[model samples]
Target: MTPTGDELLAMLSALANPLRLRIVAQLAGGRDYVSHLAREIGISRPLLHMHLQRLEAAGLIVGSLELSDDGKAMKYYEVVDFDLHLTASALAEAVRTLPPTDQEKP
Candidate 1:
């Protein structure tokens, strides 16, 4: 499904980070667990989790829980199938649809 204006902005914001971009690149190969991703990406689990949450919220990635061999629960994440053709006009239109920021608040 095509993302709504706010949804597109959220997805764009989620991908704006370098670390999150790397996470996307890694997950592009295959689904992976948080610990493994943190190790591979050279970051802490907490940090990875923060980025993962954002990606999941933006619908850029999907996460599922699984029981490992030793009966341990693991959460794995993978990129979702989302196609976005971000042209200048598309971005401008999307940006125009966003609600005013807190700075605009009285």
Candidate 2:
């Protein structure tokens, strides 16, 4: 899907961080729970949650709360199926849909 200018910007901004990039790379392998993902990525759960929230906001990753066998709650995250084909034409189209900002107005 062609993202709007704001969406494109959000996705780019979300991916611009090294930590977020690592989170995406780790999730690319498979879906994982919060603690496991944190351990694999070598970051604290809270920090990972911040990154995950950004990814989720950008539509790059999705999370779901599930119950473990023992009935404990676990939050799992997985990379969403998304294909972003960025090109000049795509950017132009996206820009056209952008809302006017104060700085953009005369």
Candidate 3:
């Protein structure tokens, strides 16, 4: 689905951070639980969660809660299969469908 301008902006903003980009790259390899993902990325779980929430809010990634073998609930995250086609024409089309932003209002 073609994202609306606001959605596009959200996705881009979410990925603008280096840590967030790294998080996406790591998840691109495979789905992983929060604890393992935090460890692999060498960041604290709380910080990882902050980035994860941003990705999730942008629809770039999704998280699901599941029970581990020991009956512990774990949150697993994976990247969403989204294709962003950015070009002059695409941007124009997206802008055409965009709702006016605060700055755009007189």
The most accurate candidate by lDDT is 2
Error of 3 at 57 (Å): 0.5
Q: Residues 18-50, candidate 1, lDDT per residue (tens digit)?
A: 999999999999999999999999999999999
Candidate 1 clashing pairs, residues 3+ apart or interchain = none
Worst 10-residue lDDT window, candidate 3: 90-99
Give the Cα error of residue 21 in candidate 1, in Å. 0.2
lDDT of 3 by residue, 33-104 (tens): 999999999999999999999999999999999999999999999999888888888778778888787999
Identify the runs in model 1 with alpha carbons over 4 angstroms from their true place. 92-106
Greater-TM-score candidate between 1 and 3: 3
In candidate 2, what are the lDDT values of residues 11-89, reduced to their tens digit?
Answer: 9999999999999999899999999999998999999999999999999999999999999999999999888999999
Clashing residue pairs, backbone N/CA/C < 3 A, model 3: none
Computed on alpha carbons, the lDDT of every model, listed in order, comes to 0.92, 0.95, 0.94
Best-to-worst lDDT order: 2, 3, 1
TM-score of each: 0.84, 0.94, 0.92
